[model samples]
Target: MYDFYKTISKTKIDIVYLGETVCSKRKLLRRDDWLEIAEQLKQSGKEVVLSSMALIEANSELAAVKTLCSNTDFSIEANDMSAVQLLKNKPFITGPSVNIYNPSSLKMLAKLGLKRWVLPIELSKEALSDMQSEKPKGVETEVLVYGRLPLAYSARCFTARSHNLPKDNCQLRCLDDPDGLLLSTQEEQKFLVLNGIQTQSAKTSNLIMDLHELINLNVDVLRISPPSKHTEKIIELFHKTLHKAYSASEANRALQKLMPAGGYCNGYWHGTNGIDWQETTEEILCQLS
Candidate 1:
């Protein structure tokens, strides 16, 4: 992901989420640092959000959650059930990592003061439509429009252990590969990326060209996960398309230059394999050109 302050200052992004969502061990930015960054982002005319860690284990981790919940300056996105419990009776954004699979759960969270939710990487358009149909009043839906799908998180630091070290003695190996260390099959085919304890897809999930479909679904926001580089260009493409200044094909071509590879997919949204891409039709391509 890009540097939080650098990105917020550079882009016309509507919302900026700060905090370590992957591994809490990543202490490059402390809680106070996040709050400071949030303050800076607020001044930049963006809605600032603090994202809770996806995996919370120890009491210290729980304490971090408490601090964020108690802070009244900005809203926080609860990623775990513990965070949800801590923030219950108070309004907060429910992140995709939470188990919000159906309308009942959505309503329950809404009752608990959840005003917004990011759709999980696995949810399809049909499911989203069904949930949106019965959403509680004032609840908004945001989709994981782009990013390396964060598949799973573990307590063990796989990246550290790979270099023959313990979790506590990880020695900040993760920083060496800012985008996570890639893992390939025995046959040399690239697969997953090891980011401390978080496992992400090797291929980044890009959805800039799916603006039409997202608008049709009535999605309120399209979340682009922070990339290590070229984030400004990616956001600009989306910013242009969101305002009808750029066509889908133009956005798609711009994204090719920003991805780790030329890989693009929207299979999860279409209810197919997660790696599938719904190709642009001839008429749509012609119009874009």
Candidate 2:
């Protein structure tokens, strides 16, 4: 967790999101601890937002979300409607988990004091274009431009089940894999990653090549999910790409070098399967290897 925070700080990320978004069971950092980190980030002259658990199963989790929504030190990124309801009439950011597919939903949230929102992973450029054509007044759009695509959320803890443990008594086994556990098919082919209750793609979907396209679409921010390692490098590549200091080819190469195994994918941006890499070059693969 410190590694993740340090990477963001060193990279000079404009906004840093603290708190666990996947499972509440992973409690290396508590609310107060996260708020303290937020204060440190603010002291460094960066905007900080606290994120709530994506799946709010129990009242305890809901209460934690409420605390995050009510925290005055930083803005809240509402991951669910419960949070949105709590943050109503207060300025907050909408996380990608909140399905704001249409303009009406977005407008409603904007009316409720939503200043920025992250688009869902499945949303293509065409969908973003349609949504932006009627984007609510003063609502900034953010996209999950880089990272492993969070495929689905399940009530049952996949991480616990993998260890043959009951969900109620997970023994905090998820802490064993900081980056998430890799799952494979019967043929032993790597497929998806089990991130507590969330399933993510084995291949990290990147949009360095689509940076220009996203800029054209008027995307306000590009979110890069924290990876296991070299997160600072990924942030640098994204920053350079956004500033036009790095060419598409160069950024793509940098991304390929940063990720492991299955490599860079940008299919969702192209309106296809989220695992497909639209642009590939021999030089990139050589550098990646």
Candidate 3:
């Protein structure tokens, strides 16, 4: 894990989100370990944010959230309401899991100390423009430009269940599939990915082709959810594209080769089926308008 952070630290990624946002049972790194990593990343001139789990089911989990929220050194990305409540009056970020769907919700959270909010994965680009227009004075907007969309989270451990093991006694099988265990449809079509309690899109959400639209929308940040492999290259691709060193088309083609077996999807951003991919063209942009 240290080596992974050390490697990415040299990349053009500006902000590094640390800590486990999924199942609490995956405890290879403790709170101290995360803080140490955060320190190292900060020392490397990268802004670090500690992320909390999406679903805080137990008292132990709630306690863990409290510990993260109390950290004076780093800001917390509140993934759950419990983390949000604990982080009230403190400058913090709301993760993608927290539903800030409208201007009203954004306003409410901002009043409670929302420094920034990640647009929900399912929201269309049109919706983002609307939110941005009414976005508060000091708050920032962040979009997940890349990664497999984290669709949902349940108390149940799907990874463990797949292995025919109960949640409590289940071995930490999620480690075996670091990216995620891909699930397929009846006809053997790639469907969704099972990562413990979280369900993610089988196809990666790639917005390399839509960087122009995002820039036009006045987005504050472009987030790339780190996959297990080729993360440094992915960061470099986005960096070069963002800096105009590489055109979006060239970067998009390069990204295709780096992605896993499942193809790419950007339909959710188009306000359509999440699994479908639509090429960004002047005609398509006009229709969206």
Among all candidates shown, the one with the greatest TM-score: 3
Q: How much does candidate 3 score in TM-score?
A: 0.97
Residue-level lDDT of model 1, residues 45-92, one tens digit each, is 989988888888899888988888888889989999988898888888
| 183-230 per-residue lDDT for model 2 (tens digits) | 888997778999889999988888876676788789998898877788
Candidate 3 on 129-168: residue-level lDDT in tens? Answer: 9999999989999999999999998988999999999999
lDDT (C-alpha, whole model) for all candidates? 0.83, 0.83, 0.91
Clashes of each: 0, 0, 0
The 10-residue segment with the lowest total lDDT in model 3: 280-289
Residue ranges of candidate 1 with Cα displaced over 4 Å = 1-4, 282-289
Which candidate would rank higher by lDDT, 2 or 3?
Answer: 3
Which residue pairs in model 2 clash with each other?
none
1 versus 3: better lDDT goes to? 3
- Per-residue error at 179 for model 2, in Å? 1.6
* Ranked candidates, highest TM-score first: 3, 1, 2
